[model samples]
Target: MDPYTSFQVPTGDRPKYTGKKLVMLSPDASMKNIDAEASGAALRLAPSSAYKSHEEDYIKAFEEGDGIVFEKFRIAVINANHEEQIKSLLYARRSFQYEEPERYLYALDGPRSSNFGVLLWQMLCRLFGIKKDPPEIDPDPAPKDPLPESPPVFENTGEAYWGLHALDTLANSFTGKGVKLAVLDTGMYLAHPDFASRQMVTKSFIRGESVDDINGHGTHCAGIAVGGTRGESGIRYGTASEANLYVGKVLSNAGVGSDSGILAGMEWAVEEGCRVISMSLGASVEEDSNYSNIYNELAGMAMDMGTLIIGAAGNDSRRSQGRISAVNHPANCPNILAVGALDRRSEIADFSCGGLNPNGGLVDIAGPGVEVFSSWKTPQEYAILSGTSMATPFVAGVAAQLLEAFPEATAREVWDKLVDQARPLPLPVRDVGAGLVQSPK
Candidate 1:
């Protein structure tokens, strides 16, 4: 079957291929068999255990060889142009399990084009002095015992981001100390003053690019997950203030990346024993499209290795127009925790995707995503943005806190605790899942 036939996107929105292919081999597949099937294509096999010690060599091999095999994941990213050979390997050889064209994924942030339309309409209304009624604010119920503090509404104060207050992070005693949290995105600004005193490890998977976050999306997401207080405002915006940060530049400075780079980052994070892996990037999928088996399998493997992967549900929905899109790829994978976005009112964000499809395409939880303020690239220092991308790292930081609070718990157990401790909201389960995620008190 043609791999592309199973999924469809809008005419111009169809993802572009990277002129490469991802081939998943069986666990017992032999290197000799892969070479024989490759028809003389140059290939390199990289053992997962050697990634940490020989990180640079592994990356170099991937770039120089026709393809590189990840021994741990039993997967290979190869530069293959012979369609017949690939088909023969898939159909004739039992060693080859699956194959798909490598496609690019984008950082999931920034305002959608439709948002500009709304902004223009509001401006015209102001110019004409046309008075409009205030938007209705939903009433959220108070949390049960142990969470005695009422949920704080959105406030642009200089003390802390409203997201931290809504999750009651200030009241939590756990600081995520000793936990390893990985943020896989467009890299981070290593010299940022706010993170100068924190312990961090950094790497870049995008060829020719360093782990310097020029795109700012990764920096903002990292700020929400593990950043400290700002020097000037003294405001605490991050959640896991002391978690050991692992910054992996999977996406490039252009805010785009292919599956090979992303999967390589995932392998590194899992090998490093990171307790939580946060990915604020994804490719859009249609309502009837199924989740990628490759990502689902990798997610399950990571979970078994004691790492819980969290991803954005995508900013493809337009609630005002009554168009709700399905959860994005990877996040739609069952093992990867899918996080939806919530607005300042504790209501679902207008652009947050919904569980419009069955079989693993669902929103597992939500976080404060609208008008979220966090760290940015140099000069700007800080900025406010909105998207489900912001919500993902918020949950990842909370996961780190949970790992610190329950040091003996497994990754799966921590996932269950997040769902159980979430404060129930008066909203549809499709949008909010178990409701707003909360930190352990």
Candidate 2:
């Protein structure tokens, strides 16, 4: 059995870990120290091979398999420099570090920590470039900067039953009661100009860090979902401009994270009482397998409890991805609203994953996900990204609006309304579930 199962840990429970760790210092003899990257680097020289080569006699003596017990095990490469940075990271001092983590941190913790994660919090940061010191970018900028005026009143989009027009119609019917929609992704850019008038609740799942967006994906979704639903951006006036936002940082800077991290965010979302949880993220696990059922069960539970979970259909447009339908995970859970991508030109995105399950269970909706621009970290900037990542939010933000219209509605009711309004695709039923979700009159 998997250790996770053996631990009897419910998949719905967020991974609660004690924010504690032991510290160690490199001996005086180590490699030559180098200039700073993120945290301070302490250089030192070290002797080679602290332990002699293991012999068969010693191996046999310790064959019991439970001999030496480490108080803690974390990866770090032993080098003359970057020792202090590694120390600060383990103890949770620095927000990030830029270095060959595998060379130092991996050496200390072992290979386990150096995989996908190093590519995010460590590697991507290096690729994008890192600062030698903390960003003092206007520390404590005046909070009194007069909030910008709310944008113009949204005109009705007539009644588009599905796709973009329906989404636009939903925008016109919003109640502006400030319903909460939590998005689990990289993080949000709370300070963007399009969001100056909006309120946000932010949290982090990455252990020590605060909710700082690194990949820019999460923030972009935030802007499109319920951003400043008005202004020169046109009716780009976010789908639910009146809704509140909760950003849950699960993916790292490299756009990568573990299943445990995503699960942790889900648990937190339910606890926060968010009316809607939009997850424009997903994975393609092995098909026709129970390997992914644990996640599906969790999503189903969330749906049953009245929370709507929206997920991306992934970017791989294909019929079958290695015995599995192209539907993305959490999205495949039958309970979720799996959204696929459509380019602005109104065509299925070549890379938009599709083709339904042989079991008949996914791709419940489609939306315009390409060339869509939204919030960035700076008030004056934004990023135009495309993918089902953008499509899922289109439905979620509208669901928040639906909540305003049907406050007494359950998750199923919300789905019913969208289904009642969506435009049916000509493709096979399995290829595009119940058509595209849309706004109802």
Candidate 3:
């Protein structure tokens, strides 16, 4: 009988593993040492460095039963189907820092039904002349000083998207020139007209998949981060208009991917010296659950190597139903900046996750997300979508701009500048950590 036969997944719940396990080696462990240890268990491991220039072969080796190690992050992905294999690895635990089952992650785009419900509510409020009560400001027993006034409400015009207006991107002089920015998602539409002339590097970590985005999620996100003007409206949507784009197809065309592929993309970004990496994907976690230690370590390492990783605070909340989910994985890792979603009214999006868990699971900032307009896959050319997924790229693009402006600043310094310059809002810190993200003027 198969061991999985006894297992039953609850409806709507994602399976915890893909019959694979992730292992983080001890800091000083090398490929030579690890190989010797694995040989004792009759296991063969392949190093990613050997196939760095040939990713297809690397993935093929992994799929062909060779335990593959990401040398930079000192992490490995191995099959976990046999009990003896797992036991053997556990027996040599001293050679590893940590080990866990790899979980599946999905694109953070808002669910269609949720987006429709939000639109309906807004329409009803407008038709009935219903006004929402002012948000109650958190009282301070010993207030140091009054908070800055909220930013003016913005509306999209033929000239630009409301997000760009809200961030004052039009007045900003920096175009993020020379900055190497990466967007890891479903992939991008290579032939998108708006981005035809821009500098771009592309790769796919998903097995048997190309970097061409079948799903529009990645194209929309890449547009928000670095695309040019829209053809019809001449509207400006992207932030870092001249940044060198690095497109990493970590998630499959189905908008789902394993941690192994995601990690591979991350390693590639860091190796290529990317200044900022934007990830609009995550797996939902319970309010009481802790973040993934593996991601936390990897993100910290990436930061030390001068790369900043930004991730979407998952779209799992139902504020209308009085439920707010905690910030999701990868983003919940302390070193990765977690961005939440905001609407045109500058209020938190109804479906935006919050910081319910302590420690690393906190929303670090907010960006325009609801009904966001940007480039989509061909035939459509453009689209309007909602979710923290939209918000994340806005922040990533701004980070690239800041990097160009302050050429000598470290990755951590850029993170500080973002929080320091954000326009404070009349909302709780749990929902909007440093308030709304703003472009430097």
Candidate 4:
């Protein structure tokens, strides 16, 4: 029922939850039949179209158990706060009652308020089976150039990073020719002279935004993966220079993106026959966390269809201060390659995240990330940034190179070759899994 029409609201008060909500339901709730029940409930409180709009976003119901993962719901609650509204809804729906079969209804993300906190605490303790408190959200700060006093030495190619040079040495026979490589991130600055000769397939998932990358992160990553041998400034950056580029602007110009948009881009990349899909974005999660079932399933499906996904292990650690963080999501999914960052000295970068969680949460490889220079959005046209985000695309480029070398290799075979050829490092497996990523000879 519409919370406003179903319950009385205090005069002049505002609704606490106006944003989207994420919900997880019990295993018994069939997605096929649940729509009618959900719409019926919505009609009791709001217009029928309210549920109709969100219908397409639901994942397919499982066969063994009809559970849905990270299903989105747009909910409003008149003048009552989110917690109060949810409580009232649960009471009315009676789905959470001990006697009811639907005993696992949970609101994963909601308004941040005392009542909401209390509700989440109660739910996590009683239903979600997660004992630890939810981890705080801390986005890694934007990467900056290394200290001026200690500049990194450039390779023979004029690139100050070793990742591309390493790949060039190990896989000189393949240039990722004819392979489709997709980098999904902030939009690209295609007008940059470094990419002037390369024809690119581009699409912007962000509504009302152009494919031009204003943030520079996407262009930087693209440079690492498939940029030309020489930029307008004469620096040789990028790997897989001969590969076909598919630029999917999943994140907006402001460097923010929704889960739905990113997933859509993933689907598009796979459909376009991209052999490698690289993503340098993720959200924080607690240590020893389980992989995201949603992304695990999505990536696994893509892998079965012959596409390999690569993502950053995240840059949430501060080893100098001894604060360690876990691998972030999507990359935390086992089917995807989670890449960590290495410095010029072959040491793990101070801010590169580690593999604290097992099962889909392990770091698969390392790449040169510290003091790395690459192409950026125009006006500046080049940048030097440090993060696991930078390391991820280097591996993606190497994956493209692998595809070029072994044209008939399955996605799993390509993944195994990279792991098999990885140069062993001195760091712990959690810090640099199979060690530095190596190219196919």
Estimate every model's Cα lDDT from 0 to 1: 0.81, 0.53, 0.84, 0.65
Better of 2 and 3 by TM-score: 3
Cα RMSD to native, each candidate? Answer: 5.6, 20.4, 3.6, 13.9
Assess candidate 4 and give its TM-score to the true structure: 0.69
After TM-score superposition, the amount by which residue 346's alpha carbon in candidate 3 deviates from its true location, in angstroms, is 0.3
Q: What ranking emerges by lDDT with the best candidate at the front?
A: 3, 1, 4, 2
> What is candidate 2's lDDT per residue for 1-441, written digit by digit as tens?
110111222334233221211122222212222112121443221211221122121112113221111111111223223355456544643322222211000000011222233224334555777733222121222233232233111123333212345355544567336677898887776656666766787766553344676567787777767775434535453667678788887665545544544555666677678878888765553455322444555666777777878877766553112221466565766667777765433445445655445453467877666556566655446765667787777888778878988888988888878766765544333444555555545
Over 1-441, each residue of candidate 3 has an lDDT whose tens digit, in order, gives: 111121223458766567778888888988888888778777778888877775485676566655788989989887665447656766767666667778878888787686676678778887999876333332223333356565467898887889998788888788888999999998999988888787689998866678999888999999998876887567899999999999998887778887888988999999999999999999999888999988998998998999999999999998776778899988998899999998898888888888888878999999998889999987897899999999999999999999999988889999999999998887777887888898887
* Among all candidates shown, the one with the greatest TM-score: 3
TM-score ranking from best candidate downward: 3, 1, 4, 2
The local distance difference test score of model 2 is 0.53
User: What's the distance in Å from true for residue 288, model 3?
Assistant: 1.0
Where does candidate 2 stray beyond 4 Å?
Answer: 1-166, 229-237, 287-291, 318-325
Better of 1 and 3 by TM-score: 3
Ten contiguous residues minimizing lDDT sum, candidate 2 = 101-110
Task: In candidate 1, list every pair of residues with a backbone clash.
Answer: none
Indicate which candidate wins on lDDT: 3
How well does model 3 score by local distance difference test?
0.84
